[model samples]
Target: MEEKSGDSLATVLVAGAANLTIALAKLVAGLIGGSAAMLSEAAHSAADTVTELLLLVSVRRSGKPPDERHPFGYGKAGFFWAMMAAVATLVGGAGFSVTHGVHEISHGEELGNLTPSYVVLAVSFVIEGVSLSKALSQLRAAAGRHRIRPLRLVRITSDTALKAVLFEDAAALVGLVIAAIGLLGSQWSGSALWDGAASVAIGLLLLVVALILIQSNLSLLIGQAAPRQVETGIRAVLLAQPEVEEVVELLTMMIGPGSIMVAAKIDFCDEAGAAGVEIACDEVDRRLRDRFPGVNLVFLDPTPTRRS
Candidate 1:
């Protein structure tokens, strides 16, 4: 878990640096070229920079050890901050781009020299691609550990910092391409209509990404269940114990990144005395922890089996 957090920190840092540089370049280019799409791309990079900063905080704060006030630890802090970062993207990136694009469409500006805009878009794409590669490297490694495809892991993984970076960087790359296309269209047609339309499209793209990240973080913050495979493996571990006759009910929650809490009602064998039950509980706890390090908390209640 510590290693995962460390990877997330490095990824966010790289992305933040790249975005800061790209934002300045895009802003300058937008002003020189007088392109709405280019200006919208600038806003996108600025919001991404803010998102990365928040994600850095999320990664660091969430890694703190369990404390007296927070026995479950600060893992969910990552989710909360990631959700805030998404809101930033929604407001700063999507809102600005959409509103400006619509205004530009109605009250268009005469096109200026677009050479700088094209050059900046090309350069920004390369930088965003590098940041995205870093995220994909981490994602692929994590997926390999879980023996799942990278795409699938991204959807279900509780590591919101990583997910945010991957999504934002990918969007940055796409937005750059859209900006370049808009610049070309406006240059060809001698109208800002295409650039305005592209800005709106870029805003819509960002809106979708932000909503996805927000939903994912909100779900995890609300104590979403651990993945199905994790729950199944935990149940198997419990039923493997000789004294446990039946698993009456099992409940699990994702208490933090790379952490899960499990509670179950178990029916013990008739011949197993209280002493045997106690021993079994100890063994079960040790086994579960050893088998699934993420399963940090476990509670077992012995109950009589109900028959129809």
Candidate 2:
């Protein structure tokens, strides 16, 4: 947990720094270049800065100890903030870009100062790449331990803040490249329409990525179940104990990244009466705790089979 928290904090910090730099640079470049694409990029970076800050707060809050008001802890706070960030990306970033793109297309104005705009885009791309590398390093370490792909880890892991930052940085890099291409094309062809079109494309790309983040965070907030393989392995471990005859039913839900709570019904063949069954259940719980350190909560109910 400590390692994950540190990684999450580092990722948010890097993202925030990158967005701050990119937003300011793009805003100046856009005004000087009179390019809609540059202005749209400025808005995108500004929104991302706000999102990264919110994610930082969410990560800190989620790490708090369980309180009387929150029995399951504040883990879901990260998910809620992540969802809001996605919405903000759609509204504040993509919305502005689309609107500006439409206005540029209708006005058909010529853009100026292409050289400084390209320079700013290049610098922004480099900064975004650095942020992306930090996020990927953390994600790769976690994913390797779980023996899963990075994309799959992002989809299922409790590290929604890291996931969000990584995605946004990646999208920002791609958007910068697209904007540069459009700028160059318009400069060579003497048509500002291509630049406006690029802004629209960037907006659409952000909208798609935002929707994905929103859906993923929603799933986490609604209580997604743990992977089937992990649950099966846990059941097998419980049944391996001598006091546990068989696991009748098992249900597992992820409460946080790398943390789960399990509720199970088990049958015991080592004892006959209710008192004996209670003892067996206690033993099973201890064994499970010893075997699966990631399981913070375990509720085992003993049920006697007809044969037993």
Candidate 3:
């Protein structure tokens, strides 16, 4: 657990530093070049930097030991922080860029100084890609154990920190591309409207990405289900117990990333006496814990089956 926490903190620090540097550079370039696209990129980077910081804080706080006020530990605090980060990205970054883009379009100001804008954007893209690669590597390592593709794993994995970082970095890269295209269109055609249009496109892209992240985090917050395969595997393990004649009901929900709480009712064979049935249920619970390390809480209710 300590090793994992240290690794996560290191990842967030590296990514956050990259974002801060890129944001500063982009903001300067945007001001000097008067390119709407550059300004949008600046906004996006700034939001990313802030969100990364929030993620770092969340990770640290969530690692705290359980206290009287919060007996479950601070793990869920990470989810709430991640959700706020997504909202910040959408509102502070996307909202600002879209508003500025509209203003530029309305005022019809010609873009100026293309050279600086291009330089900053190219550098930003490289830096953002590096940061994204780190997050992706972590994600792949974590997801590989589950034997699922990275994209699908993001949907089901309990690691909100990884998900938030991946989405932000990916969006930043795409936003950079959009900004570049818009800047080039304005430069080639000598119409400033193209620059503003590009900013709008980048904003929209970020908005969509942020919304998806927000929805995913929210679902996890509300307690989502463990993957179907995991639940099935747990059921199989339980049924293998001789005392467990059959499983009548099984309920599993994710209490945190990669952690689940299970509630099940099992029926014993008709011939089994009360004492034997109790022993069977206990065996089933023990086996389930052995099979599914992620099952934090397991409750087994024994029921008698009708004689066939």
Candidate 4:
């Protein structure tokens, strides 16, 4: 779990640095080229930069060691801050881009030399790609460990920091292309309509990604259950114990990224004494922890089996 947290930290740092650089470059190019699409892209990068900063906070705060005051540690802080980052993307990135784009479309502005815009877009694309590759590398590493496809792991994974960086970097790459096309269209037709429309498209793109991120983070904050396969594996381990008669109920919750809590009610064999049950419980804890490293907390309750 600590290793996974470290991976997330490194991923977000790389992304944040790339976004900061791209945001400055886009801002400068937008001002010099007077391209509305470029300016909207600048806003998009700025919002991504902010998102990365918030993710940084989430990663750091969420890794704190559990204490008496908060026995579960500060894991959920990651989800909360990641959600805030999504909000930033929505308000700062999408809202600004759409409104500015609409304004430009309604009141067209003269465009200046677009050579700088083209150059910056190309450079930003390469840099954002680098950042995106870093996120993908981490995602693939995790998927490999779990023996699952990267795309499937991404959907079910609770690591919002990783998810946010991946999605935002992807969006950044697409937005750059859109901005470049807008620049060319305006230059070709000598009309701002193409550029303005491109800006709107970029805004809508950000909007979709932001909403998806927000929903993911919200679900985690609300204590989503661990994946079905995980629960099934856990139950199988419990039922395999020789002293156990049945597993009446098994519950699992994601306490944080790479952290899970499992609670189960088990019926013991009539022949097993209290001491045997105690030893069995201890063994169960050991086996589950051994099999599932993410199972940080486990609770076992002995219950009588119901008569048929």
* TM-score result, candidate 3: 0.90
Question: Candidate 1 clashing pairs?
Answer: none
lDDT tens digits by residue: candidate 1, 1-308: 21278888999999999999999999999999889999999999999999999999899888999989999889899789999999999999999999989988999998898888888888898999999999999999988887788998888888889999999999999898888888889889989899999999999999999999999999999999888877898899999999998999999888777778889999999788999999999999999888877788899999887761
What TM-score should be assigned to candidate 4? Answer: 0.98
Better of 2 and 3 by lDDT: 2
Note the Cα lDDT for every prediction shown.
Answer: 0.91, 0.83, 0.80, 0.91
Which candidate leads in TM-score?
A: 4
The whole-model C-alpha lDDT of candidate 1 against the native structure comes to: 0.91
Q: What is the lDDT of candidate 2?
A: 0.83
Q: Which of candidates 3 and 4 is the stronger one according to lDDT?
A: 4
> What's the distance in Å from true for residue 18, model 4?
0.4
Off by over 4 Å in 4: 1-3
* Candidate 2: stretches off by over 4 Å: 1-3, 270-293, 305-308
Q: Higher lDDT: candidate 2 or 4?
A: 4
Q: Candidate 4 residues 1-308, lDDT tens each?
A: 31298999999999999989989998999999888899999999999999999999999888888999999988888889999999999999999999999988999888998888888999998999999999999999999888888998889898889999999999999999998888888999999998999999999999999999999999989989888888989999999999999999998888888789999999999788899999999999999999888898999999987851
